[model samples]
Target: MSGIVEVAAAVMLRANGTEFLLAQRPVGKVYAGYWEFPGGKVEPGESVRQALIRELQEELGITVTECSPWLTRQFTYPHATVRLNFWRATAWTGEIGITAPLEHSAVEWQACGTAATVAPILPANDPILKALALPTTMAITMAESEGVERQLERLEQALQQGLRLIQVRDKGWPPARRLAFAEAVTRLAQAHGALVVINDDAEIARQAGADGLHLSSGQLAACTSRPDFTWVGASCHSAEEIARAGELGLDYALLGPVLPTPSHPESSGLGWPEFGRRLNSNRLPVFALGGMKNELLTAAQNHGAHGIALMRGW
Candidate 1:
């Protein structure tokens, strides 16, 4: 590897966010015929966002009206080591491949959350495809407040309504009761094709057969290796903690008290600007936590959150 080359990449999503665009590399380029997200090298004086906007206009003939930082990854190709700064482009103007001369041989929309139909995708994009499958909303169970039985009922209803990600986080419950509740949640979620993650208790997560484990901040600091779970995440409050979670290769993280919540009334929330600042150039997907509601999903995503993780609001 010589010097690191910075690249700005866009995952241009459809209006419903169920599909994203992939472009085939034009002949004569490296990895010609391989498919990848459309983007280009970042210039010295340009920010990643600026590069993204410019690249899209020049290549696809569209003006990116809305986008947000998502993930940053580095891959060492035989030719060069590229640092890919991935952004989620939600809204754009003008028709793709019409406003400007086509830069690539072809382009097509790929379905999100499923195996890609396109062949010979760039190897560096495998993890990016997986990350895009995570839902935009995560519901945290409040069994202690609602009572496990009522909570279970609510969980079933949410699942029916298409809630696919859940976190069981009642630390106050007795060990036996907590385990039972986790098991029940796992079963219910599995039935609906949803995923369940137990909070802080690896033993209980295993016993309940949950899909993953969520480490508390303390547990995150104490952990020396990634836990053996299909999906792992951590509760993070600051940039340092978020970076730590990423270093551990966790799938995602919950960051913030983006707004003041009933759970912690004394501390002021990080606010959106600060929240976005902390998440700038971060690698893993992160959900906005604390006082989050369904209506704030767009706001959260605009400020670099992959989604919102809700407790009471859900």
Candidate 2:
């Protein structure tokens, strides 16, 4: 392959942030007829942000006002190796008119996290879509600290307040008890249109009909291939572990103690600066995991995290 081609892609969310636009490649271009996020090639001397702004203006006819770097994916096509830099375009000015008729044949906004309504999407974009579907806050179960009944009550309140991503990780319970709890959590989560991932137990996740699995760092290191789950994630403490999660094709990762927490009082934390440094230009979405709360959402996102994950105070 020659020098890698850098392309900037947008996950342009509507005002509600629940839907994003996808465009069809116009005829005569490579991958013509395939659907993809709207973007174009980065030119020499242009940063990814500069390319993104230019591409959106040229293709969608809108001026980007707010966008955040999310993920970077590198794929080798038969002809060339391409690196796709993805940004979440949260806000823009002007209506998106089809000004670049030569670039896109059609454009439509679709709900995030749902199965794609558009057919024959670009092969390199599958994980991008999955990442977009992840919620901004991942709520972990605190059943041990809060009694099971109290926890269930809290889960209901959290779900009602729009907590869409969850993890069930009460590992001290007996196998039968854990399975039962997983089943109950799944049922409640599904009812609220939330997703539940069981920690470190693919069998329990499967049997409980949970949406995914969350691998411990040990489990992640032991894995040779991606687990068969719709939304597999792993706990990553170091940059090496984060890279391993990406190699294993996990949909997302939880990285930190960005701050010192009661759970590990003696352990020093990554802090915001180090957390940002570690996650910069990472290929997959990562959630800031220790000592996180809803108020830190912006802080986490500012540091290149997809969102924040919390055991308490979500």
- Give all TM-scores, in the order shown: 0.95, 0.93
lDDT of each: 0.93, 0.89
Candidate 1, 192: how far from true, in Å? 2.0
lDDT of 2 by residue, 1-314 (tens): 68999999998988787999999998988888999999989999999889999999988788898887889899888888999999888888877774443358888788988899998899999888888789989999978778889889889898999999999999998878899999999999999999999999899999999999999999999999999998899999888899999988889999988987888978779999999888866888999988887998877886789999999885
- After superposition, the stretches of candidate 1 with alpha carbons farther than 4 Å from their true spots are none
Which residue pairs clash in candidate 1?
none
Instruction: Give one digit per residue, the lDDT tens place, for model 1 in 60-110.
Output: 999999998889888899999999999999999999878788899999899
TM-score of 1: 0.95
Worst 10 residues of 1 by lDDT: 95-104
User: Candidate 2 has which clashing residue pairs, if any?
Assistant: none
